[model samples]
Target: MRVVHRLFEMLIPRRPVSHQAKDRDNLQDWKNYVYGRARSAWARGLPLYGSSFRFTIVYLCGDSPADIDNIIKPIQDALVGVVFSDDSLVSDVDSHRRFISDGIDLTNLPALLIEGALSGEECVYVAVDSAGPLGSYL
Candidate 1:
């Protein structure tokens, strides 16, 4: 999931607000929406790199569908010969699914932990349900 994490870090520059913050509700909504898109992408065998892949661009504070589209415009412009779309926004599940189906590899995406502040404090962050690709990709 390094790729996903790295991409997320790159895309979102500011440190994320603590999960307890009131704004966190909005953040969580966006996070969940993005996670679903990633899950769908992983189900399909598509490479994350290159123009053919569609990326989910997130806007944190005042993020709207139109705002995200504007932010990712440059990324799309730079990478010519590839199809890119920013159809999903925070709290929008239908658009998220549509973007995921457009062909982005999300095999390395991180799973969301929705509990709360206590959940964030846990040392063992995440657990996988099945024996899946972990070290193979690296």
Candidate 2:
């Protein structure tokens, strides 16, 4: 898949919230936190990306072993009306969880993730790219 342009990219300096958060209060807090961070980074109420997009989420952590799959939806839903208009617009997605302390193979990882691990912060690296093929035809 071709990435036309990066619509949004940020190394969120916090652990990603997993969809498995069954506690209502905790889930609400996570949603609020995501909204606050995303809203602040992006304009509060700007036009959302409407075309096909790709999401690449990397969870860099030392211990919290949440399923990578479970974490994706919450983050994606949290970005609704902020990053992209709808989930249906997502053409591709890549999600991964990597441990920092363990000798992670640095070859494939991006530089920022290495830096984050070195900094000792369990954070989420999220990037959204515009998928060119379908969008280009329009």
Candidate 3:
């Protein structure tokens, strides 16, 4: 013999001005707000995938407060996990050092010495090729 189960509904109170009513209203507003925020955020982020990649050298350029904040915000949001050099560790260099430093792991720091040496050599070669003063003679 086969048995069939019937669905039953319990009538819950839909009282307004009560805690449940307030919670329902708050939940609806929260859902709408979150949906809007997600839509806007995805629209803004979508273009990044199609954009050409530019390798930026973030050396000491004496950036403005807003510029620094703008650069840091994306890194923080993406959780890129940056490892700062010694110069970045000096006193009073960064105001939000405490917050920024917390996520970084020192063990994963890139080799500055090797990178600097290689970059300098590459720049010199590029400069020599561009400064072709004795072009016709060659």
Candidate 4:
């Protein structure tokens, strides 16, 4: 079974927030906000399926510098119960960082391609694919 799930511009943290003395409050706030958004998005989307799957996270940036690693953690954590039963079901994971510049036609960009682009505004895409136990290797 193959399943693809997506959460639009729901906030994703670049990294797990550190609970250092100075940044505790801010970090907690960030964690709360991101986690809440992810949960809400997952709750509203299609139900999860598949015991093992490949997950892809595409980050759309708007003229800002961000670490891909930092952005994926909150998402992975938040999806634990909502998307899959647990994060371990995500056997293979990949991430893509994209920069959308002004005046660049979005229609022709290969990386920006999505399954249903014509229906709504562009946002982050999370795709999960389960290749049926060994996929093509068997």
Candidate 5:
């Protein structure tokens, strides 16, 4: 009842949030944004509960000094039911949040958003692969 081989990647044109005071009120908005954007962009009929998947993510935090770990859970939770059946199925993972000026060239990444990159907008880039190549994603 799960996908054997698959890849789901998306670029959420928004900012990453955390449990910090400044982000608390916006958590709901953040979740809603991610879910709606991802769902609309998904071409597949429905999300499958994969046996296990490698989740790779890189979020642009614009200017805030948000903790990467704190930013990760909300993003993962947002993808639930949209990208996968549950976040527990995410066995392998690589995630990070940084400023747009981090100087990382993400052009080679399949999920890179050219508009976001060119406009220097904050966004969350995610890739879920059932093939399990966590290192390659990093």
Candidate 6:
């Protein structure tokens, strides 16, 4: 199986309100950034994966906490055409969020931590691949 990974080295924008007259600008901005990143990554010519794919996302954030569902929806939508041709092809999604220190620690861990005890700049890592019979579900 081949897994394609892309990291957007910044905090993912939250899904904006959907009232067309109210938050249109915010909604558009969020979509622009997310889609732009996915489009750029897609340009790398990764293989067009088959169905039964897995999607994994790791979000490293600072002190402020955000709703997991809100954070993941944009990413899932952004990757539709770029990663899997369509979202229906995805069969599994595993996602996580951590305040840097809550993740793997190394002797050099302190160097990566900041005043917030995590990198001030949030990071979103997305990995996708075509695979089957994964984990306990299989």
Candidate 1 residue lDDT tens string, 24-131? 475555455434444443432432332223234333322212233333433333222212222221111111211222333434434431221122221111111212
**Against the true structure, what is every candidate's RMSD?**
15.4, 4.1, 27.8, 6.5, 4.8, 6.0
TM-score-based ranking, best first?
2, 5, 6, 4, 1, 3
Off by over 4 Å in 3: 1-22, 44-138
- lDDT scores of the candidates, listed in order: 0.29, 0.74, 0.23, 0.53, 0.73, 0.56
Per-residue lDDT of candidate 6, residues 1-138 (tens digit): 333343222233332222232566775666677777777656545535555777766666656655555666667776766666677777787776767646544333222122223434566666665545765444
- Which portions of model 4 miss their true places by more than 4 Å? 1-28, 43-50, 102-123, 131-138
Candidate 5's C-alpha runs over 4 A off are 1-6, 20-25, 111-114, 131-138
- Better TM-score candidate (3, 5): 5
Off by over 4 Å in 6: 1-24, 43-50, 101-103, 106-120, 136-138
Better of 3 and 6 by TM-score: 6
TM-score of each: 0.23, 0.79, 0.18, 0.55, 0.78, 0.64
Model 2 regions lying over 4 Å from their true place:
1-4, 43-45, 103-115, 132-138
Question: Which residue pairs does candidate 4 place in steric collision?
Answer: 13-71, 14-70, 14-71, 15-70
Candidate scoring better on TM-score of 1 and 6: 6
lDDT per residue as tens, model 2, 37-128 = 77776743663655788788888877857788988888888788788888788888888788877756766555666666667778887777
Give the range of the ten consecutive residues with the poorest summed lDDT in model 6.
108-117
Give the alpha carbon lDDT tens digit for every residue of 30-118 in model 4.
55765576666564465455567666776655555356666565556656666666777777777776654432345643333443232
Q: Find the candidate with the highest TM-score and give its number.
A: 2
* Per-residue lDDT over 1-138 for candidate 3, one digit per residue giving the tens place of the 0 to 100 score: 322121110111111121233466654553344334334333223222211121122222211222333333222222111111122221111212111212333343234322423332211000001111233225
